[model samples]
Target: MTHTTKNDPVRAGLDRRGFLRRAGLLAGAGTVLPLLGAAAGPTASAAGTADGDPDQLFQAGEFAAAGRIYARQLHRDPGNAHAAGQLGYIDLLSNRFTRAEHLLGRAQRLAPDDMTVRRRLADCFVRQDLLARAAPLLPAAQAEQLASVDGTPYAVDGPQATRVPFLDVDPLPQVRGAVNGGAPATFVLDTGAMGLTLTTDAAQEAGLAPVSSTAVTINGRTVTTYLGVVRTLRLGEFELHNVPVSWTDGSIMAFPDGTVTAGTLGTALFYHFLTTIDYRGRALVLRRKTPAQQRAFRAEAARTALRPQPLWLAGDHLPCTPGMLGGYGPRVAVIDSGTLDCGLNTSAANAERAGIPVDWDHPIPVNGGTATVYPATAARMSIGAAVAHDVPGTVGPTPWEGLTGFDLLGNFTHDFFKPFAVTFDYTAMHLFVG
Candidate 1:
């Protein structure tokens, strides 16, 4: 779901009051009544009928109607944590932050252990500019059931062991006049970056000319930098020319590994091809999609949307409100290769708290540190049609909305899904391929 402020006329097409009334009728008639006195609970038909209508409406992009149905359900069962969490989510989609917060807060109070509620509540804080409050909830959310790392519950297996198909490319070759004298170096594949970036040493070795220089911050503080254009870059079966590149002045040649990779691949690479990163399989796949494939991808994107999970404080174990990733709407997990761990904002943590098991034994290194840091364990991790067991993940601070990466990617044949379309459904917390 995406949110648009009242000032943004582009999203003001729906009538909130009318939609809410109709939703109330449908939810009461279809769901709440049937579950009132059943031994086994509501029948599948009842639940399906009740849930299906709003789901269909949501899928059809009827945001107003969907919001109303969800709202109605919440009114009927003010204590139904799931309904309340979802209602808060609706408020987020409509840019009703205050209302969303209110409903989400109520849901959390009703179900203090619900992770989904916490995730949403965290999002409310972020939207309201409460960064400090939002930061603490990330760890708990990342520790939920789905976020995985390595092949274990917390560590991600590298590409070498996964055998996922991938197109291999060396940024060095595309670099003009590169010295090519050093030993072969590896580079991290980063999707979160806005453009291509290389280490100062690599850029100098490649002999690329500096067009300009600036200061930028990474991981934390500000640093001096250089910007330039590459004459040509070749990777696998594709080639690009005169691409813009950025280089840091620091000696940080690569992630801590320093051997497995030397540079980073950013969003610049994805604009030209459909790309997939399989962390479990330790591979990156890239290919051009056909026109038909492109249409399917776009259609799936439109049909799927991300639900915001609540962010939790680092140590506090409690449910928060519900929310969704804002601008991206419906797509398989938004990739943020820049992020070090698979983190959930507060809302996701709340969702996980509600349904998934919590295992803290699994520990994984974050920020390339071996000591004094570890993430949580995930009970299940799935991407598209593939699923993995005992995934590991952690929570951390974020500047943007939400993202899915390493924790889930490590389990799949990353190379096999390249050039294919992928969509993530935050409501279902599932990934689908088109």
Candidate 2:
């Protein structure tokens, strides 16, 4: 849902009122690392015929409230394609891919022309890495182009340096940067994203040249995308060249909190450096690890008893780690920064294996409403050695395959802000919460 691309329009045209916002990333199957929230980030559908305060709740970011409203509506009209479709769309926004697939698929059967349901169902397939299934649902040219997307490897210029101020936007971190050496433009820092993302307006203002194309889902709408390279992207003192950038309709630029952004900074560029999100200070620090610093960190890890979680490569070239959910079993979770809630969102299998209890009592939020999200809890959940006892989470069947049989973990800031820092030491492949 979060990952996208852009260029010339592929379909006949897009009606803004019906379009969903641009978004985060394809959830890695093992850990299911898709960015789920009310932001214009990774979203689901907006097309069900049902209507009510659910629409307002979805817009208000009260996702749980919206889902409950729709679930109650479904009780009166079990065969309503609109209710089922809308519920499924919300599930997708909440990162419940399998649920989205089931609902959206049923919706499509009930209302074949519901473009929103079709697009969202395709998104469920894409999120599951079933590219073959998604390709057929999108424009042919866009599909062929996406099949060949190869971004350049990122390289940090110098030794160790950089500490830039940031603005906390709900669950996201906002920073300023120059595009093609242009004046400063605001960018949402999303770890779930892969490369640089610019709305067409921003890309044009920065003079980017398009070279590739693809169709991607944002919220519940599908749009054509062209891949281009930026000559130079200057973030504070850190200057990066040959950066892969996505250009799409200006939809991704709008944040849920009402802030308009020029683009997003994803993990593709961040992985090359050891980065830290200083929550209290609202700062972003990027530096190459020095041998001395690495040794010092190792010693500190031992002292703090910080378990070292190995960062492994996931789709879109992001690093992930094998962790335990409810301390029940091992699941590879992505270190995602673009999320709206706390704790892990798990598959039924993962939750069951860990012995987590599900009440089938919680409501899941979406783009325009909500769906069923069971409340579940874990006795203990750990990433490396960083553990949370009596962790709160949701469990049920999901559309995602999961990163090594896991979904996602924590609100990067809200849940983990108590630590001195939540650091990603890419060079050493370790995540430290201390």
Candidate 3:
């Protein structure tokens, strides 16, 4: 079955009081109640009366309904840390960072020894760009809790992990391509990026000439970007020529740990093939599916659109525009791959001048520190041939003009091609497949 959080569409308007009453009865039946008290957050009442329905709602991804139940519980007993922590989580998911921070902080105070609360609180700091605050708590947070099982800090083990099946070419081939005539080098498969971006140093060494240039904004600042062409590019058993490349100083961050992998295979390559990233097997499989497989994949892809996008290492993009969230007019947003929800800038108007509905009745925590998020239903978004309506997103204050991250990409997964065989033809406005 497809698992979802309490925010599932089907359970939107559930009753609050009845849920809590049922939860209390369920807790009474379970012997695990006593053990849970010392675990974290709120202390069970003498009868251990808890309306477990809210907890069930949370587990089911009905975040809004779960929040309502938590609110009622908190109203009855303000000292309930469990309710507070859950409330914070709901807020965090909704992009309500400030409120989340406050509630999470309270939960931590109520249950000082609870590692889960601490870790969640730390994550909030990371989302808010307060990395320094999060660094201290990283050691205590379990890696599994940080992100999904397929996420980082874990690598595939065993012999099967060593091979990747996608490359029709040889797996470990050498290349004679250079950025500015410096030295022959090899690159690695990187499905995370949207385009082929080379480091400034690599472009300078390969003797590639700049074909054109433009400026794009990053972290609220504009930076110049260079487009160039490579005479020859090579991968395991594949090679191509006259390929386009983008050069940027930002590419340096790709090698933060300094492992000697040259260039990266980006989304430009993956779009051409049916790609599978098997994290457990430690291999990326890419194969040209048969016509039937293609048809099936396209059908499946339509449903995948609503799922959260993976926050890969590649940077994110958001279109630049003046848009309203929470009834506010024109606040800059950052298209954040790392973020699971949409957020509004703090200056956005809370009054509903546009038809947008600002969710003040249900405030959610953004992370777990001081921020809270207001939910909003986006009326429409226009992109190329795609139009999204009634999309649920968040409103928050950010330092960027706007973000074009996964919310814009919808459910499109990228394919990274071996050099030369694939190209992103911006001028032609099409992904040219070999």
TM-score of model 2 vs. true structure:
0.58
The candidate, 1 or 3, that scores higher on TM-score is 1
Model 3 lDDT per residue over 1-434, tens place: 11111111111111111221111111010110001111222232212236556765654335577788888887898888888887876665444678989998998898887665665676566444354565455441112122211221111122221224332232222122333334655554433233345555676677655544444332223344455455555432333344445554444422222333345444434433444443223334444434654455445545644221212211111112223342333332222111222312232343244455667877664322234556666565322223345655554433221111112112111111122122222111122222
lDDT of 2 by residue, 1-434 (tens): 22343321211111111112333223221011122111211223334444556655644334567778777766777776766776776666444667878887887787876655665676566544465666555544434433433333244454466877886644467788887789998887666555577777788989976655545554445655666567778887877766656665544555555667787776656655667766657877776657876776678668877666656433233445556765454544555554444445565666777777877656554332222356666777766656666655556433222221124332122343323456777665567665
> Whole-model lDDT for model 2 versus the true structure?
0.55
Ranking by lDDT: 2, 3, 1
By summed lDDT, which 10 consecutive residues of candidate 3 come out lowest? 26-35
Superposed model 1: Cα runs more than 4 Å off: 1-185, 218-220, 255-257, 278-283, 289-333, 337-348, 351-374, 396-399, 402-434
lDDT of each candidate versus the true structure: 0.37, 0.55, 0.38
- Runs of candidate 3 with Cα error greater than 4 angstroms are 1-192, 220-222, 249-251, 254-256, 289-434
lDDT of 1 at 132: 54
- Candidate 2 differs from the real structure by a C-alpha RMSD in angstroms, to one decimal, of 14.5
Winner on lDDT between 1 and 3 is 3
